[model samples]
Target: MQIPVVLLFLGLLTVPGRSQNAATEQNSATDGANAGEVEEEDPFYKSPVNKLAAAVSNFGYDLYRQQSSRTATANVLLSPFSLATALSGLSLGAGERTEDVISRALFYDLLNKAEVHNTYKDLLTSVTGPEKSMKSASRIILEKRLRVKPGFHSQLEKSYKMRLRALSGNTQLDLQEINNWVRQQTKGRIMRFMKDMPTDVSILLAGAAYFKGTWKTKFDTKKTALQDFHLDEDRTVKVSMMSDPKAILRYGFDSELNCKIAQLPLTEGISAMFFLPTKVTQNMTLIEESLTSEFVHDVDKELKTVHAVLSLPKLKLNYEEALDSTIKETRLQSLFTSPDFTKISAKPIKLSHVQHKAILELSEDGERSTPNPGVNAARLTFPIEYHVDRPFLLVLRDDTTGTLLFIGKILDPRSV
Candidate 1:
């Protein structure tokens, strides 16, 4: 089966509070004082879009950590770019004080804040371009009767390409509309987005995305069979595992993380990075905490290309969560109670809840043609063994723009 992925995100913001300045003024002043000194730019952050992508990707890592910590035993999957996009677009509608809260949460404090939205337009185009096979859409929803400021509306549309929605007060109709919009954005890949309408919504941010990937090397269908997947030291489950005796992949062993890292190429300039712990029932907290865009990039560069006797599970997973509590646990707690969105509307508003859902599938589907010429030319030696039989972490990244499309921790394939 083809590997299809879907992600949907919604953030609900409602009623009044005064805006308070974030505590970054002292630091900002210090940085400003030192700005006169000329310094070489870091290659990673040299471009505006790259800088913005790194900041948001870092936020994605933090979001994944928080969600993973909450559900320690269960699988955790998130397409945080969608959530980050929604929040970034909503920041345009925020007053200075409230905007700082969002800015800090998204790590925009580290970026040239003035060009963020504009750079995001470029980043969006690059990641969701036709060649990428990814479709993404975001929107802002308002209360039934709330009037949006013309300036905020225009800026949001111009930069974020998002439409504003005013609730009609009919719960079912509003719910239907939101779901339909999600379906339309994902080309019918995602059906129902929300089960019910949230009450007292003053403003809402919504985003959806869909992606399908084909592996560079296809696994033989005949080799796929039910195999034992170790869940823990004492537990195991049978899952359909795809095997390839001679798989060419980039490999690395992280002594610090005590995990094997493998990089597999996918079509459309995307790559899947997997981190398999050294043993079953090992604590993954260390590896989870170590995840960052820079670190992953370093690992990506340091990995070695080699032949591997590989075995991977055929996985189809779905996840849905209301991330209000998770967001509260982060640095963004104040948004739930006290936030100023006067720019969006004169009336006061604060964030209420965040909802997220994602679906991912991976199977033995790819080009039936011969492997890459490099793989064919390599002399056979002692091929390393890389089996994903235990719990593992996965990251799907867009190579061209360095955008994180998805992150997942698979504990039990059967559970999904």
Candidate 2:
């Protein structure tokens, strides 16, 4: 599947309440006179689901950073929420030492560990509800005929809504089943998730997600045309570009990163944020490093509403990767080696492979209503021109829960 290239940086603010309160108290004490005034806690930290979302989304950012660093010259797209879900579910089968490794990796150590799974259940429902356009699924595939403990199987399904499967030992049949399950989960939007089954599969983790989002304000089809998209300083490629003369969007320029950030609303409480560097050949390492749940939350709050002449590519992207190597490079290396999974089964087993596939589409389709007159009335003296005509970063997020649904680094629009 062909997918566009874009990079996204989200600031995830997920400090535990106890520590945050302690710091607040210390600051008040230091400031003496300000001690009488109590700062209101951020409502985001009050919800367990939001806390879990921040933790998993942070993992997603780290995963994206690792993958982008390795594939520096390639377009990278990942819907890592599913991967996080799979790993989080897998943790239920881990013993103490292995559990700690997984927990720290997911940043569960920063949350109420006892409520992680339950809160995750709530998060799954909120983000994957029918009203949302995203579909994500995860599964744990064990070695053929492995005896999975009934308790572990039940717990995984009950919390993560994931099922455990023991391979049938028929490579082709196993391949077909895995792909079929993915297709079913994504409502057939993603197909052929796997071409072949890996040999000696002790434990395989699979994750897949598909998103087809519609803009809150539609772009006129008549205005859409082929346009030049800069790949770098000298090279350019033709890509289908959607345009809007008076686009109302949230905008900000980050001096530190040397990038212009624009946010557009999509249906179902979702938003797509783009980070466009001033220069085509500009390195995106700084922007990637700045992504965290906290930072993204701050950006969301700091951006100003404005009018802009907007143009962006119409994209349909598909990305599939064997993430075993990428994951092994992280703290999760132990899982592929001597980690324990006694909770899952008595027989010794280790993680063999991890696979991920993501499909995302953004087009000109949206509600038929015209731009709000009130927004147009307050347009800047010289409306800002926000054109995504160069290599950029994109982040798709769920507004209600602050979940990082998708993050991509688009070096070239023409790359699939």
Candidate 3:
């Protein structure tokens, strides 16, 4: 299948008890923090399931925060401690079940929707002593679960079944509602729920993902400049390259096969590596054929260090993907059928609407709206190195898990 990847794919960081204390761990790497460097300490790094979870798109992704405009009240309560423990699985399944087929192929399908909620409720029993923030979160999850009826297909129906307005403009989404809901739920952790929502939104669209992560050792903004990025040898694209003097280094290779792998580390013993063919973007089959957990973790311990410059085209992608096929192929298929869902999904819910509306105001409401609003309009166009004119791949790795969280190959930029 010709997999169409969105450019500018972003991810959210989930922080627990102690924030990600990203003090550079490696002595060889930089000792101090850079301008935009964000210290991210994530316990999910230790989870095997999550290692593959982010990369595996087979399962449905719901952008649910403990609290939000998401009006559903779940009957099941998830204990904070258990939830945290459960989430640790994310890092564990990294390389092995990271693939769509492997990740979604198996599941806890035997459990009915109610059973799922009860299990979550049982886990909530472990939330005896959480901070007030954590307790409030628990209550919200219970409410969210109550709203998750198997019969419910679309979120509006599940939570606000009777509240949808057919006259609602496809483009006019109450962004504030979504944002406020998310901010409260995530405790201001994940911001900007979605930069843009697809206009072709439809039913079965119960969730959206809006995540942003910063490197622990951020590159100095001063060093960031226009660099030549090669999409293909003949096609030279100009892009932004965030460079620093030092970083975690590792030598990776696809022995007896053809691929490129590099262990790029994060602070606090966390790191991520990129694996591709010596020739990427040119012959993508090598990337497709040689991708696996063994392929991912089988980093060549002994390899040469090749000094090179890296330039990544600044890209933002807004994807309009249809998850129907993917969902049916995965474990959620029966949710729509008579045999499995007939009992709970008593409502014949055909996706009436699942449109996502996102807006990029460019400028805050009533500020002079001009490409170059200042007297420096002449100087504005002089430094236009941020133009993204090609395709690229983005992967977010959690060092604790040694897994790639989000993976997307962007061939288009306007979507963002």
Cα lDDT tens digits for candidate 2, 1-416: 00112222232112111121222333454566465655554688688888788789888988999999999999999999999999999999999999999998898877789999999999999999766679998889999999888999899989987889899999999899999999898888888898889999998999899999988889999999999999988898999999998788888777667888889989888999999998998999888887877667767876667778899999888899999999999989999999999999999999999989988999998965576555533345566889999999999999988999999999887755
Query: Which candidate ranks first by TM-score, i.e. highest?
Result: 2
Which sections of candidate 2 miss by over 4 Å?
1-41, 372-378
Error of 3 at 243 (Å): 2.6
RMSD of each: 9.4, 6.5, 16.7
- Of candidate 2, the 10-residue stretch with the lowest lDDT total is 12-21
Question: Which is superior by TM-score, 1 or 3?
Answer: 1
Each prediction's TM-score against the native?
0.88, 0.90, 0.46
Among residues 3 or more apart in sequence or in different chains, the pairs in candidate 1 whose N, CA or C atoms overlap within 3 Å are none
Which candidate wins on lDDT?
2
Q: Could you arrange the candidates by TM-score from highest to lowest?
A: 2, 1, 3
lDDT of 3 at 167: 19
Residue 21 of model 3, lDDT score: 11
Q: Candidate 3, residue 332: CA error in Å? A: 5.2
Assess each prediction's global lDDT (C-alpha) against the native. 0.78, 0.84, 0.30
